[model samples]
Target: MDKKEELKRRQADIEAMGGPSRVERQHQMGKWSARERIQYLLDANTFEEIGAHVTHRGTRFGMDAVQAPADGVVTGFGRIEGRPVYIFAQDFTVLGGSLGEMHAAKIQRVQDLALKSGVPIIGLNDSGGARIQEGVDALNGYGEIFKRNTWASGVIPQITVIMGPSAGGAVYSPALTDVIIMVRHTAQMFITGPQVIQAVTGETVSAEDLGGADTHLKRSGVAHLAVDSDAEALDGVRRVLSFLPQNWMEEPPVVKSRDPLERIDETLARVVPDDANKPYDVAGIIGSILDEGDFFPLQKGYADNLVVGLGRIGGHPVGIVANQPRVLAGTLDINASDKLARFVRFADAFNIPIVTLVDTPGYLPGTSQEYGGIIRHGAKVLYAYAEATVPKVTLILRKAYGGAYLAMCSRSLGADLVLAWPTAEIAVMGPDGAANIIFRREIEGSDNPAETKAAKAEEYRQQFANPYVAAGHGYIDAVIEPEKTRGHLAQALMALYNKQDHRPKRHHGNIPV
Candidate 1:
């Protein structure tokens, strides 16, 4: 054959791996092929696909007769919103998108490019796990990809989009990434499928309930963002990337802020009701203080009590960890503790500053929490805060009690500046709870026990329910008015923009998992 005809024939063979039938079936299942996904995610005409002509090396079990397109994976470098990024999409239409030795090599090369170039890398995972024909080569392929995921972590941003089934050992690669975006009604991830569970444990459960978008987002907390469609998931990825820098060495990009830096929001004064029992959206305070009311909440469905996400303060990127009083009174439970710890570490790793908004009753005290290793999980948050060398600024919004107060980025945890509102009550416990123990004899001996107990509680509140006590001892740097929250935070962030902190020389700490 002539050179021109040979090139065309090879291109045709690459496109013919799954034929038209399999590609159409993938589309019918509401999933796009690997090429289509790359086209949608990256800028128009920017994707330079790599390894399109690579072939599988397996020859066992009639593998020689099998022609896998791009070895079931399409990898390339592209630009998203004018910023360079490396990406890979698994071609589920070809060999069920199973990973073989060459498929893994394609992904690892793009990942290496991303790391070397100091650019973000995204993986669009839609695989049915390892290829059976390749045996241990397939397993080794997964192991190689996972090593790259770990090596690239923190040094550069890593994101994963679960567009389809990611089962068996394949799910760990995404787990190692910084962010995960999954599509609803389609994306599913589990260590074992439902059939395996039925065969072993005999527990019957639907796939959706087992490892779907809802399951991971709301229950397992495995996915960072779970949207209705692949487009939405991709948009989520773009939004998150906008807040992060290309790498840890660089600062996060800052846009122009329409909201004035000195804007005082009086609404914050009235946002928190006097009735401590009443629930309020702490997100309101968060939105008001942030630039353009932007608060990108993470793990929103799971551990709703502790709200955490990346946001801009004075147009500068920051990680906001706030206590959501609307759920479980913003108490720190096991899941909430884990959420806070992981987020703090991520922000610190990426050179993003940390801002904590505190208003918690205390740790969630319950039999279930204790049984679920709340002590161990809660230690994770403490260790994260103490170990982080980033600029830490904490604001006490309402109640800060007991160890929970210390756990929520208090001064002892090395907060650069701990600011509190006038309404903040930094105490060992609530007034009523403390009054009961301290005045037990007085209440028990009094003829009017109820009235005496009420008076004692009232006395406790008057003395310790304000921020002045903590301010006097320097636990709180300043007790600012609610209206001045945005101004204070902006000033604080600017002053500490180039903060530096030291840590002992060590490879890495063994944090409580």
Candidate 2:
């Protein structure tokens, strides 16, 4: 037990407990080890792994027979695109990548580090739920992780990638994160597996059909983006991070650009429909106005009524949340509200300034919508927008009416700059709906009730529907030409690029339900 002999014995223990073997296994899996994944995800060779020597304490069930590197969960700090970020990647090969006591402790440690450092956290998840052998200890592991997620809410960005099978309670971590990315064939996520469902309901289903990229992206909207391969999935993560700041306290990175802010396109003049009832593609207008061409749409098919996308205005990445009047008359429903809320919170998390293009009639009015909790769902959109700390610029491309207007980044909700196009119509309600309510007495009193109602509606439209009234009342910041939208938004973003809001000695605000 001399000094020299003790040092040699420690070195031998490290080699015997899967040092080179774990490294080789990473190559065989056609993927990097948990540690290697952290290295590649971060700036080259910048990761400094913490708790690399921690291992399982269990010895009775031959647990000592296995060697755990980083406790099967690689936790560390590294630079992503030259900015510091905290990351964790679970090693699925190690004991099915279950969360044990040490593994959970490692995760919480890095999460606390991320909170202290005020940096974004990226989690590469590929686990088989909790470690059953640990029983209550495993549940406590998850409880600690959940506590970190709740504490980190609105303070830093949390990203989760489901690179492999993640079942049971493991799914909630990603559910609380800002974004979730899934690989097409490799990733599978669900609260419970199909076997459990079959046992409970006597209905059979496959895992892929139950929870795959197709199911998540199209049906559940659980995953924000899906890629065909692991490489693409990783690339998607980088692309998403590029638009975001390290945290809410910092401004999003701005790149030099040659695109002119005032560059006008002929399409902008004719993009909107002259008739109020007719529908036009909002995406077309967005595509035409954003920088040259850098529009990246998220959740495109799942919630068709609302359009959420990432794009560059003068080469500065911005989150674009617009209402698609073409679908369901651009009405806010439960699903669309949920989709918009998620996108808004995501943008706010990373300090990516938001640009909302509103063209909505109002919330969808129907028995199905009411029963499905439209009021609860619609409030999410308002809460998200109101709580957002990033600079928000909203444009009224066509119709902006009622509570929908407030939910869509109106001036009252702390919108830094609100612009309206000449064709915009800002009203308490659509003229037809207003006429039905206010002019009921006049219309019902007329000999020709139908003709009187129609005339009243037209009269109301001419008097109160135009953007001029909104601008005059200071409800809108500016009434710019349609072609000038790109420049106006870029300027507004630049003006508020250094904006910061610090609460008055408060740990956090009450996030509205």
Q: In model 2, what lDDT does residue 457 have?
A: 95
How does model 1 score by TM-score?
0.98
Compared with the true structure, what per-residue lDDT tens digits does model 2 show for residues 74-116?
7778887888888888887677678988899989998999999
- List where candidate 1 sits over 4 angstroms from the true fold: 15-17
Segments in model 2 whose C-alpha atoms lie over 4 Å from true places? 1-36, 441-451, 498-508
Total residue pair clashes for candidate 2 = 0
Backbone clashes in model 2, listed as residue pairs = none
Residue 444 of model 1 has an lDDT of: 95
| Backbone collisions counted per model | 0, 0
Span of ten consecutive residues with least summed lDDT in model 1: 10-19
